[model samples]
Target: MLYPPLHHWLLGAVGEGRLNWLMLLLAAPVQFGPGLRFYRTGWAALRHRSPDMNTLVMLGTSAAFAYSLAVTLAPQLFPAGSRHVYFEASAVVITLILLGKLFEAIAKGRSSEAMRTLLQLQPATARVQRGAQVQEVPVDAVRLGDLVLVRSGERLPVDGEVVEGRSYVDESMLSGESVPVLKESGANVTGGTVNGTGAFTFRATGVGADMALSRIIRMVEDAQSSRPPIQGLADRVVADFVPLVLAIALVTFLAWLLVGGEAALTNALIHAVAVLIIACPCAMGLATPVSIMVGSGRAAQMGVLFRSGAALEELGEAQVVALDKTGTVTQGQPEVTDVFVDRGWSVVDGEQHLLRLAAAAEASSEHPLARAIERAAAPSPITRQPPSRRSLATAFAPSWTATRLRSARRGSWRG
Candidate 1:
């Protein structure tokens, strides 16, 4: 039978004069089965010199059991059969508390799985270039200065600096920005970002657990383990509340025996037991877990992932806001602002010359300034050698060449 039904049977027997060894034997499993873990965990916490809500429940339930056992076995020790035992009430309270804990465990397990999904995005293997040979190896085996190859549609496996070639990198996984970023030599690439439309070689700067994705995972994990202030308050209340309730119950029992006489003793004991069973901190214990589940699930749907209950709580209280200057506040894309020329420079001739110079200098660059130069020179038709054939002398002809070289860089632009 279920705990509630069995508890009713045991309670009825105890209320009448039929308390027996068989009833106690049957009730023992019902009391201890669901609650055994709480006792074990509470004992372990105490052994380790820590106290928790489990400790309060353990002490309260143990007190109830000991008192009821004394009353059941030896009624004369408690002013004849006038006063009553509430072993069933104690058992029911423990069962309810255990049920709450089971629900909490299930909720926490799902949250942990959400974090696991984030961790799984990190690629295990990376294509590394050693001298002139390229080989696929475990990402952890990659070291600093190793050249890692990333291709179109593949996730970058380590934080690195682009050393050869160019590609548009989709960094939405880390920055939440939708547009692809063009990366070339000296540009920083992060692990878990997708490469777009081009092949590139990058020098590894971070590997294994030191990668950007791993640090994000670590931040989430740390948030999950940290407790919020509300949880701390609930824990403090539970710690002292259980013992205070037990003391009240004791006083109630004594007051009934002394002031209200023997006839009122049974009624008074019943009231005390009822208070103990109803005031069990089950609802309070469940409060934080339920809020966390609902809040985290809502955040996931909105593309915001919280690493822990503490993070959720802190986010709710946050007032001062800091935004990344480039993407969060202003559009990261730059637009042409003005065109200025040296004194006595012809408007038409100077414009054409500046455009040519800008296009050539920025032909191999992937910076926002380079892209702006390319866009400004798009309408003009200009033929230039491929990036590989172009000498380094032509590529680094000062920042002014970007404006003049803009037209040549336009044809190769994909963004």
Candidate 2:
């Protein structure tokens, strides 16, 4: 493109002969350097009698570059207007295709982020009770029936049943529930779920790969690897599509050569190269796999894991999507929307006083409702009192014990 414009600027500073050599110098690296992969794959496919998108790219770009090189080296063989170089054509095509593959690579890397995040959810160590001694051991060392101890604000190491303690467990990781579920003796608790403001001892029933979190991660990975039916059909079509395009290009080259016209050789080669370039099957070969991998990965990021690529493809045809209200619509967190106090209770600060008392009572608990009350009373002045004999008695005593205050409290709740 700079040939005519820049050449006319300095009264033909660079002659056409030198400019042609310059084009060859610049385009040689682009044709063989980064574009070598296409040549190797395309040749291998051809020798195996199975042509693909790479074959089309190799044939088209090679034909254009060869014709241009010949024109530049020996311009006397062709007419004046016929002696044109296509260095930009070959270079641009290869650059664009390589850039596209780079973007596809980036998308593939992004798709694995969700899987990495899910893998991080599993704790590396578990607190196991062994003959009256509680020891922290690698989670992989934990065996079925082992007693696992989970404390407040800790994630369960494996699926188990509560054998000896009472607590509220935040199972929102699996169930998407806004409120923590109460766990007691014989209640089943899953791994990866967080414990509330109480401690509990449970017998591990599912360890290692058998855990629910592991199964979920495996499902997401399988979905990413599984091929959709449409991709198989596309592969079949592309297998035949390449040969058909080659046949068409050959027919075009023959027809143009045999017809009576000026510069018939040049026209035949140009038309055939055009046919090859226009018939590239890159979209057909790349579209299905790229979409499946990217869509499944993005869905996993949004907490929607598919079982297989076919399921992901079918999801596109879904007209109505049903979603649960709690986590899906509302954020799955509780808030104190309103305060209700009885007229019989004598309170100096009204709603603020009631909220402060409630926050103090539930301060030791980690349940969603307790957190909500605490947030409501955060702006008000709080009186932090050390644990006294009377307050300790009130904390442990069943009369003053609120249902949400299951955790052991070390301070007084007389705010």
Best by lDDT: 2
- What lDDT tens digits, residue by residue, belong to model 2 across residues 245-266? 8899999999999992877887
Model 2 vs. true fold: TM: 0.74
Off by over 4 Å in 1: 1-26, 40-52, 63-88, 263-275, 314-415
| C-alpha lDDT values of all predictions | 0.70, 0.77
TM-score of each: 0.66, 0.74
**lDDT, candidate 1, residue 34?**
71
lDDT of residue 42 for candidate 1: 72
Q: Pick by TM-score: which candidate is best?
A: 2
lDDT of 1 by residue, 1-415 (tens): 2577876787686654465354456557866877777789877865765646776666666656655766668766555534455566667667666665565566556566766877777788999989889999998899988999988789998899998999888787788665578899999999989887689999999987888888887877776667767889887776567667768888877776677664666556655665555566656666676676677666666557666666788888788877654554335455556666566443456665566566666777655567777777777753353343344334334443565467457765221
RMSD of 1: 9.0
Model 2: number of clashes? 0
Question: C-alpha displacement of 382 in model 2, angstroms?
Answer: 12
Error of 2 at 210 (Å): 2.7
